[model samples]
Target chain A: MSRLLIVDDDRVGVSALAALLEDDGYQVVALTSSAGGLEALSAGGFDAVITDLEMPGLHGLELVRAIRECSPTLPILIVTGYTNSPAAATAVAYGARRVFPKPVPYEDLLAELGAALPH
Target chain B: MPADDLERVYRWGWLPLIGGCVAVTAAMLAASELLFIHYGFADPTRLQRVLHLVRGAVMSFALALFAGWYMLRLRQRVEAARESLRAQQAAFARRAWKTEQAVGLGALCRLLVHEISDPINGLSLHCRLLERAAGRMEPTDAEPVRRIAAQLRDDTERLQGLAASYVEGNRAPGSSERYQDLSLEEIVRAAVAAHPCPEGVEIVVEAASDLAPVHAEPDRLRQLVEYLLRNAIDPPAGSHRVRVSMTNDGNRVLLAVADDGAGFEDPASVFRPFYPASSLRASLGLAIVRDVAREHGGDTRAANREGGGALLSVRLPMGERTS
Candidate 1:
């Protein structure tokens, strides 16, 4: 089973996406706080990390950079409401393997995650 | 090289020529005075010598003055040529800058079209599917199809708005009077309707029910709204929501669109023409909005929100409606 971490500030948004991803057969860990999420990522071993672009403390791009430094091969996905936004390109530049716009189709996210994760 | 050497020699030759004329004239006058005194035909008084000396001096002075005037005229012509060359260089620089901006703007427009094309094409395909299904199904069965068609239409309009704003960067030139009393709420809603918000993104509008109307060109207002909404929408994909609010403060009405997405690195540079932002869509969108606002005697400003993301506010004066 692929273990995925989901980070977002909105509770409802996180819950809905988590449910959708769960149904797609991925073991998910969702976090709203950036500090706690960073701590968890440092300690816990996650197959893939998917995070929101904008958050209170540590931004999604910062998280991606941190993840890249700690685990260079880890597949990181940046999830944002703004698709095709300049920030999307920035997130990708920061070390995100893939960036998906908000309201990402469950199947699309699943396929992206599947492709990004190492066997 | 021989011709240039000859020209240089000719240029220096004038000084000697003028000096020779002065010397010859002086000798001739001296000779004339000596002959006048020897023959006793004229007085060799101090006044007579002074008068002869003054006449030679005046003639020499006149010749030198004429040559100096001619040299100054030559210098003026050379200076004029240099001035024109400088002007041409400045004009070329301006043209190059404009060309660069146009190319950048064109790329941005192409990207906007590409981004919205998927949703618009999807909407069109869905509509076609609904139409074919409607022809083969009963009225009750077709109800769901109708709903889907409506949603597609809404999404299509949103895409169209995005495409329109993208292309509107190159609108025809016109004077400032070409304005009308426009409803801010309606324009904002139209812009929002035209952009299919990403699946997890929510666009919320907050406007006073009794907000005063503003005098503006309808198309320009729509463009402004499109720009603002585009900026608000382009953030990292997640459960982020964009809020667009409108409020009236007696003299002016304010329209603010803010996003809980990736905020700006430098909020002050947002209004500058061709200032590269986080997104190409954002750079072009803000440029368009700034143009539209200035056209209507208003201004647009962007600032980072305290918590997160960025806020863009456009304030337009509420002119009195003419019946």
Candidate 2:
């Protein structure tokens, strides 16, 4: 089973995204804080990581950078409601494989994630 | 002259008068010597008398000039002091204005974040619920369920984008891009759906069937609509009716939002930063609206509608610029 890690400041959003991913046959581990996410990563493994762009403690971009430093091959996707052209460009520049706007289309997200992960 | 004036003049004249008196006394002494020539004192020398007269004249003139110079210097000092005070007062006013703008902007940001958070939070909850349901459902049942979750996420992301744009426009180093081809009616409806008007207030939108699409940022366009709706809903007990109408004026698109509520005295001032006319405690909404319009290479204006209430109009260029 492909294990997925979801990080979001909003409990509801994390839970919702996790549910959808889980339904798609991925083992989902959802966390609401960057600290918890880092801890999870240190403890062991996740096939893919989905994170919200903006959060209170550690932002999505920083988390991605950190994950890349530890595991260069880890695929990180940023989900955000900040879908302006500039914001999107910034997210892409920050090492995010893909950026999905909030209330993202579930199928689209899943497809993108599937594509991002190595076979 | 009045007593005070006389005293000032006397104080100034005293030095000159004393010099004059000393001159007169010296002249008298020379004459006495001339008269006493037979009593062994040589006749006062012509050169001596001439020198004495010259000395007295020079001394009196110097006294008069010194006094005048002193008075002029005093006046200059007083003027300098006044100018310094005026400059300080101006500086203080400028600082106060800057501080006020900062506070107002901060409050506006807080309000905006608070408002935006609601939808984001809701979307988050829905996503979690959907996720939980997908966990227990069979593969066949979960497919459709998963699709709904994805759509919800997409919508929420759009909402976040709109909110972020609104906040970004209000900050420094604002975005420079002009308007683009976008659906004005759709953006307005989205804003309304994102933040529905108060329960009592009724919002009605009317647009020309063939209204040309406007060239503007979709997020900013939504912000303009939200601002108008917020203003319309902020009045005391009254028949709350907000009418939003759009028209294509050849090369430009005009959107008008009119409300039948407590009208404004000078609607022009509503666009001013921290405008105090409306009963709204914080006037950032109007400021934001005006900023968003200007950012899109457009303009926004507000006015008191005929009979009663206030009306706000936003104008933008339609289609691409040929030039």
Candidate 1 error regions (>4 Å)? A1-3, A8-33, A39-47, A52-75, A78-108, A114-119, B1-58, B61-65, B68-72, B75-79, B82-86, B89-93, B96-323
Report the CAPRI category for model 1: incorrect
What tens-digit string does per-residue lDDT give for candidate 1 at B281-301?
555777767655644546577
* Shift of residue A70 alpha carbon in model 1, Å: 7.6
After the best TM-score superposition of candidate 2, give how far the Cα of residue A63 lies from its true spot, in angstroms: 4.3
lDDT of 1 by residue, A1-119 (tens): 78888887766567656665676677889888667679989887799888876554455656777788888888888765444433456567767888765445445777888788766
Worst 10 residues of 2 chain B by lDDT: B1-10
Error of 2 at A13 (Å): 2.4
- Model 1 DockQ reads 0.04
Could you give the C-alpha RMSD of every candidate to the true structure, in order shown? 20.1, 22.6
